[model samples]
Target: MSTVHIKPVPVTPAEVIAVARESARVAIDPEAREAMARSRAFIDDIEREGRPVYGVSTGFGALANTFVAPERRAELQHALIRSHAAGVGDPMPKEVVRAMMLLRLRSLALGRSGVRPEVADALAALLNADVTPWVPRHGSLGASGDLAPLAHCAMVLLGEGWVLADDGSRSEAAPVLDAAGLSPITLSSKEGLALINGTDGMLGMLLLAVADLRHLLVMADVCAALSNEAMLGSDRPFQPELHEIRPQPGQALSAANIHLMLQDSEVMDSHRNDLAHAVQDAYSMRCAPQVAGAARDVLAYAETTAARELLSVVDNPVVLADGRVESTGNFHGAPLGYAADFLAIAAADVGSISERRVDRLLDVTRNRGLPAFLSPDPGVNSGLMIAQYTAAGVVAENRRLAAPASVDSVPTSGMQEDHVSMGWAAGCKLRTVLDNLGTLLAVELLSSVQGLQLRQPLIPSPAARAAIAAVAPIAGKPGPDQFLAPVIEQVRHLVQGPALRAEIEAAVGPLR
Candidate 1:
C-alpha cells in the first residue's frame, strides 16, 4: 500500500485518487504539524483573553449573534457535530467517505482551520486503520462545505456514529477505534466548525471524475476510429491539416489519435480513393473529434477549477497569519458546483455521440455492407438490436442527469445560508453519467468489433486489431443472438479497465 504525505500545500489529484480508491495510507508532514501548532496558539490566546470568535465563542449560521460562555463551549461544539450528522438515505460508497476524510485532514494540516494537531492525527489514524464512517447519500447541499457528510465523519473521531471495517462489515465506531488502538478526541474551540466547513466532498468527487474522464475521452477516440473502420468510412476529415487550420487543441489531438489508429489499415486503404462509394460519412463518424474535443475543452476547464479548489482554505473564521481569526465566505461551493455540472454535460454528450455511432452500425442502411443489427441472420435472430436500445436508454437517462444540479439552490440554516451550492448533488449525478458513458461506449465497441469481423479477410489497423483481440474472449465473433446483457457488461468491464488502453497503446506508441 502506497502512502500519501500531506503537506500544507495543495495535494495532487493523483494522490487523492490513490488514497480514495486504492486504500493508500496517509501521513501528515512535520511542517504541517508545526503549522497546526502555531495556528492553535492563536486560538488558545483568543480563548484565554475571552475574546468572542464566530465559531469559538459565538453560535453558528443563523445563530451567529448568540454568545456562549466558555463553560458551555464544549457542549456547543458537541451539539454542532450531533445535529449536523443528519444525513439520510443509503450510505455512500466507502471510497467517497475515505476521500472526504483525507481532504478534511488536508484542510486542517494547512493550519487555516485553527485546529489542534491531534484532531488532524485522529483523521489520519482512522484512514490508516481502514475505518470509514458511514456517510449517507443525501443531506449535503454543497454549501458551507459538505456539512452533513463531514459531520458523520467527525462523529467517528468522537467515538460516535457507525463505521465500516476493511471487510465491509458495519459496526459501532468506538469498538473499531479501540481495536485499532485509537482514541476519540474531544472537540476544542472552533474544531467542530473546522471539521465540517469545507468543499472536500464535492472537490474529491470532481478530482476523481476528472481522472476517469481523461481516460474515457481517449477511449472515445479509439471507439470512434474502430467504428469508422467497421463502417468503411473515410478518414479524410481527421487529417492533421484539416484540424491544424481550425486549431482547437483538444480537437486536433482527437483527430490525430483517430488518424493514427487508422494507420496501416487494409480496410481504410481499400476505400482510400473510392469516391463513388460516398463523398463522406455521417456526422457520428466524420465529426467525432469536434464533439469529443469540445468535451475535452470542458474537462480542461473543470480540471483548472478543481486544481484551484484543492489549494484553497475553505473554512469560515480562518486563522490568519496576521494573528486574527476572520470569517470568510470561502466555504460556498459554487465553483465546484459549476465544474461538476459542466463535466456531467460533457460526459453526456460523449455518450450521446457514441450512441449515435452504435445506432448507425446496427442500421442496415447506414452500416454500409453489414446486415441489420449486425445479425448473423436477419429477422430470424434479433441480434444486438436490444443492445442498441439499452444504450439508448442509458443515454436518455444521462441526458436527464446532465440537467445541471448546480443551477438549483434552496436556502437553508434559517436562510443564513440562502443560496446553497448543491454541488454535492452535482458530483453524485456526474458519477452516474460517467458510469452510463462506459456502458454506451461498450455497446459501440461490441457492435464495431462485430462489423470488423464481418469485414474479415481485409484486416483493420494494428491498433484496431489489438482492440478487437482485447474484447474477443469476452465477446466472441457475432453469431445467433445469445445472452447480450452479460456480454455488454463484460465489454463494459474491458472498456472501463486499463487493459484495453494498455493493449492499444502497446501497439501504437501512446495516445494524447
Candidate 2:
C-alpha cells in the first residue's frame, strides 16, 4: 500500500500503471495547494466582477452565447453535471475509474483548472478510500474532454451518483460519502466544467494499454523462440551481427532475445550440421523479430504519446497563472486518439504473426517431424486444430479493430464540436486488441509447447524450458486434449499473467 504523491507536475505512465494495477494510494503535494487556492481565487474574482467566462458566467457548448446570473451559477454547475453525466453502458472497470480520478486530481492540482483545493483533496480521498465512482463505458466523443465518462465521476463528488464499494456492490454516493467520513462539497463556478473537461479516461486506458503491450511483446519473443526450435528453424537470422547493421533498437533487442532463447539446445545441435536442412525457415519463424520488432517500435511511439498526455491539463477555459481565464482546444483528444489507434495496429500485427507461428507448428509439412496438430492420434483426436482456428478468428477481429478511430469524426452539441477525436473509442478498441493478442499468443504457447514436447529428448534451451515450466501448470503437458477451450483460456490467462514472463526472465536474464 505505497502512496503515489501528486505534485504540480506531470506523472509518468509507469506511475499510472502502478495506480491502475496496484491500487497505490495517492497524496497531493503541499506546494500544489497554493496553485489550487490561486485558481479558486481567480474563479471567485471573475465571478464576483461579473466577468463573462465560459462555464462560469456563461452556458456551455452551443449555449455559450447565453449569459448566466450570479444567483443561478451554482445551480448552473449542478445542472451541467446532471446533464453531462450521460454515459450509458456497463460501469468501467474499477482500475480505470481509479486511474481517471488520480489523473484528474493531478490536473486540478496544477492550479490550471480553477477548481477549489478540496476538489483535488476529495479526489485523492475517494481513491484512498477505495470508493470508485461508477463511470459508464460509453458516451464520450473524446472532445470537450472525455465528457460523458468523466461527468459520471463528477456526479459522485456531488453525491448525486453511485459509488462502487471495494466489495463490488453499487451504493448511493451520499451514504458512501457518509461512511467514508466525508461530505460532498457543492460545486463552485465552472467546477463541473473543470471536472468533466479532460482526457483522463482515454489517457488512463492508453497508459494501461502501453504497459500491457510491453509485457505481451516480450512474451511474444518467447513464443517465437519456442516455435523456431519446434519447427527446427535456424537461429542464424537472430544472430546479433545480422541485426546490428540495421540498428533498429527494438529489432536488435528482439533478435538478441530470440538468440538467447534458442541457445544451449540439443534440438538445435542435432540439426546444426545437417547438409539437407531447409535453406530458410518460413517468414513467420525467420522474420519474427522483424514483424514483432516493428510493433515494438510503434509501442515506443505510443509510450511517448502517453508520457506527454499523463501530465497535461486538458480542460476548456483553463485558468492561467496571471488569473486570466482563456478558452483553448486542449480538451480535444486527437493526440491520444492517434496513439491508441497506432497501438491497436501494432497489437494486431504482432498477434497475427504469432498466430502464423501456431499454424506452422500444427502443419506437418511445416512442423518438421512433429505429428499433425501436435496430436498423438492425429485424426482420432482433434488436438489443437480448432485452437488455430480460434487464434485465426481473434486475429481477424483485431484486424477489423485496427481501423483507426481517430480519423472518423461526427458533429455534436449543435456542431460546436464538429471534429471529435473518438479517442475514447480508440482506447476501447485497443483494449480489445490487447486482449486478443494475449489469446492469440496463448494459442501459440499451447501449440509450441506441444511441439517442443514432440521433439523428444532434444531439450530446448534453458530459456525455453523455463518458459515452458511457467506455462505448463495451465497449458499442461501433451495428452489427448481435454476440453480445449478451457485449456486455451487457462493458457491465455498465464500468457497475460506474470508467471511465464517472470520465469523466462529469471532464466534468460530479462527479455528486454
By lDDT, the best candidate is: 1
Candidate 2, residues 412-438, lDDT tens digits: the string is 999988889999999999999999999
TM-score of 1: 0.98
lDDT tens readout by residue for model 1, 165-235: 55655689899899989998999888998999999999989998999999999999999999999999998
lDDT of each: 0.92, 0.88
Best by TM-score: 1
The CA lDDT at 5 in model 1 is 96
What CA RMSD would you report for each candidate?
A: 1.1, 1.4
Query: For model 2, what is the C-alpha lDDT against the true structure?
Result: 0.88
User: All candidates' TM-scores?
Assistant: 0.98, 0.97
